[model samples]
Target: MSEQTFFATAPAGVELLLAAELVELGAATAQAARGGILFRGPLELGYRACLWSRTASRVLLPLAEFPAADAEALYAGIHDLPWENHLAPDGTLSIEFNGSGPGIDHSHYGAQRVKDAIVDRFRARCGERPSIDSRQPDLRIHAHWRNGQVTVSLDLSGDSLHRRGYREATVTAPLKETLAAALLLKAGWPAIAAAGGPLIDPLCGSGTLIIEAAWMAGDHAPGLLRSHWGFSGWLGHVPALWNRLLAEADERCAVGQSRIPPLFASDHDSKAVRATLINTGRAGVADRVRVERREWATVKPPPGPPGLLIANPPYGERMGETDDVSALYIQLGERLKSHFGGWRAALFTGAPELGKRMGLRAHKTNVFYNGPLECRLLQFRVEPEFFVDRDAADRHARAAALNRAISDGADGFINRLRKNLRHLGRWAEREGVSCYRIYDADLPEYAVAIDRYEQWLHVQEYAPPSSIDPARAQQRLEQVIAVLPAVLELPPDQVVLKVRQRQKGASQYQKQAEQGRFHEVHEGPARLLVNFTDYLDTGLFLDHRLTRQLLREQATGRRFLNLFGYTGTATVHAALGGATSTTTVDLSATYLDWARRNLELNGIHGSQHQLIRADCRQWLTRTLDRYDLIFLDPPTFSNSRQLTESFDIQRDQVELLRQTLRLLAPGGVLIFSTNHRKFRLEVAALADIHLEDWSRRTLPPDFARDPKIHRCWRITQS
Candidate 1:
């Protein structure tokens, strides 16, 4: 009957949108405030907002304001309210207190004080106090304290307006209904739908965006799907007026359903497709929304004019997923350019930088918050002008500029690299080596390890010390990378760059990339698979080239065992060297798979070559099989979860050596090696065993500069 002050709470970035929405919903006056909107409207208008304001989380009607300088003041301020007028003495209630002030530093304490004052007031007045009901309350009171002032209000939208009651099933990280609506509104979906444009969500998780879009386009009230509201049990709720509004909404929805546009939803995951189908049925948009299970790469537009294509693709927030995610964005851009010309596209992502990888220029950008994560909606017009070929043109430009910079200076580094290449290149060709180290930190100013894997170069920048300026280090690295392509006569993409740091345990085995690009390289008579991008170390260890050769030469008729057998390079050598059988042990399933591939590549498989996935230390104690030849190269330090106890080369070498020697038959040879630079053989501890230093013999000629790269010992039972 009369206009009252009302507050509608929304997400931080959605306040302006919510303000505009409330004004359109017949509010007398609406101003966007921090975190919410303040408006003046009649009771009927509030009911309309509750039904139609898709961006607002809740609507609160203020009843009183008072100063609460302390706890007693807070109690007195709340107790002074006319609680009986809002709720019956025997009814249930809940208080949601927010903000911190002089006396209320915690929300729970403030809520407790407010609840105590109300129940105490009721008890003193009628001797029957209302009980607390958190889930469903007759009266939901909200109190805000700031600057020692409290504003109390009655919450008329319960359980967050985003819960439209249609999402009975959901997938991981489903977008909230309010946020989805905000994204659609920001993308101008309403204007597009008004012109009879179709909508498609190729990576729909649970169909939140499609359902929200359908409701917006069809003039369907979001609250109509909801069964209950905060005012449903409130004493002041006018049943007749609310029923009149419900009838009006029903009639509008019935007529609007026919005006809905064709909406399509799909996902690569079958579970996600099923979830979308279930949610669409529950949202009553099943007939209007065509849902399917399809991969993003295969999804095509419906046979009609271009429209809006929006998606919330996987952000790849976890480790080891960046490369795949980047590739996905690149592929998505290619698809858009090749097929969806003239279509409007919007991609909402937590990683805004990834949006650039899409290879399309975003003409417009809008910021939104998905809970605590700040996200961006990148808007693009899929046209020829917006297409960006980052890999071809941009990469060439960068390389050309880098080459120009290098030509101006950097003679010292270039001369040294050429000298090493001329000398080592000849040695590699002479020895029939396809993979070998060409340079190892040759110049202190340019600290990097450059290895030639056929025509490709794998350059590892040794992580500079903390004292070195990082900017200077990066400049040196860029200069080195720039000059490598020209000096080596290889394409820029053929050169892979990575930072090499001190690795402790299984971290060295952790995936650095997911490119899944593996190249075949030859060593002696064996062919092995080496992945330059996916790992810290190429599957084949170049430093072990000479060692694997010696094993092959000595394995004509003996059984060979390879421990800590990463990728089983040494096992491949033994198998090809005519060993009777080969067994390779490691802790990584991924590495084991790689080993299987390597063995298969060399035409060595079946019972003769065994690949076991187990901690080398644990596996050593379990195996009773003896071998005539064994190679053990454990990490310097490993605390992998698969191990019962952490292994340190210095601390556990004695026991590890003993276990391996026990598996060694009489007169058998066991070669032990470690890259721990400071490692020393504890001779006195192994008094009964015979040990000889093979480090000098095992060290390859290319690694002569760094003899400590690895230390090998020939061990035998006394």
Candidate 2:
């Protein structure tokens, strides 16, 4: 057979790894390109590449590459290809377009033209044409144009390989599958596992790394378990050859009872352990891996010598968004240098500044894209002679840093951990709360987060050690957690540690309650009813307690308007606090009902209370009604099916907050609140109103976490 070429694309940064995978999979020869790998091989080799290649995001069989300076030329070039060889007359095909090029302004138009060309070509010859199925088509085609050259290829993987189909549930932050495989491959796990070191990921986190490592180390193909392969639907697909290829894979993957790996994984959260088990099973590697529910500090490496430890820790980036990332990173570095020795390690993180807190040096580092965020996969080597360094210092320093983080300095080491804790400790002690949580719960590298919901603080406990070496990341979390209670003054019962979870069912526990319904029953709180049953958030925001109270004190006998009313907790507060009348407007009927209940529960009655269901943004445009006071607090982001469209606070805050201004009566106050941590109020933009930020002073005694939980702006347009 003549030499045949194929293109394999990956989420940026894996092009080289995909090329490497192709070369090992028996490609005639492979070369790395901009966003994909190009190789020449036989039909069986192509099947094997699609079956076993873990690093490649999608495999594409190019049909043609030509120049199209304009849309007409682009259409003609794609229409001229042999679409019949790839798609059957009765088959369904879909098209996708990528890359920026001149003359082609719209990508959807490009895809449509190609689709039209293919369907027209088939119709011209057979008098009938294949159907178009964008959702799950028999064929997925990619159109790429760079400069004046256009390359069209068959999208051999219908969906992304990241859809491994094993995730039973995903928590706030779960690492993408493709990124996980790339991180492991970059960590040199294949070489280390193949050379005899036990492979373990103590912070397994949704089992992405554990499963990826198992497949690579076991020489098991990732795409094997997939019931469907893109090429299987192609016109030239050979059933006999496909079955034979699968049989060979089964033979190769049939591990002997003794030759299997000693993979160990642990997390303080039981839920994470369960999630890991289900994901592993879905990936077909459950029986080969042992998972445990244990804290990072207490996680014991399997009896064998330290091998390869890989972890994707929270960088306070994607999964976590607290400014305390520096402190967490410092603790992680101290733990690795103290606990892990004689081990090769790799960690993926987004916060570059926190890397300085690791204290130890990284040997090799590479950048990879994790979704829209740019992340770093850093590798470090540790010997058995490693000893305690930072953790050996003062107990108060460690505790304070862990419990409370400081955000003052911006120097070498950035000191995100020590500094945060010192300042946090001062605030906690001053406020008399024995236990307070300080953390970086958001940003780019945040692949995991510690949710302090319901007065319960959950820690990811991965990044602290990842700063140095992942060989001992969990050990560090365990050690730090052992002393955490002493600093936070939190009892054993109050502490609820959540491990990394993946795959959550809609039928399972509801993340939030109905938009306007007040179903969240209050377990505690003397002033107002607190509920999370009807919304994504429980009604009472501990951080905004003072602000809510402030509204009630000033609401006496006044008519108040609550825009984006949520649970109408403020209305209930105003009613109880002596407001004469309360009118609430929101987009969700579910929330409107909740607000009504909150008012009813507080002993406030009838005619004085009004609940109007409307998108506060659009409804406010025509209304002339005004109130003595207005309370506005909209969500930071939402994809509510009830609404006609989605809303993002990052882009819509200033405009939304400005909308609330029109509803406030002269001399009446508009108490606006936004949980977006980075909100800056755009004070100059609102020239007609006077704005005063009450975030720091409004933090109440019972809620002693970070002061930036919600920025409160008292707006009055005189």
Pick the TM-score winner. 1
Global fold similarity of model 1 (TM-score)? 0.82
Q: Could you give candidate 1's per-residue lDDT for residues 406-505 as a string of tens digits?
A: 6757778889888988988888789898888988998887899999988679999999988899999898888888888777766565688989998998
lDDT tens per residue, model 2, 277-356: 88888877788888888655454456666678777775332222222334555655656666667777777887654564
lDDT of 2 at 265: 74
Q: How many residue pairs clash in each candidate?
A: 0, 61
Model 2 regions more than 4 Å off: 100-103, 256-258, 315-328, 384-718
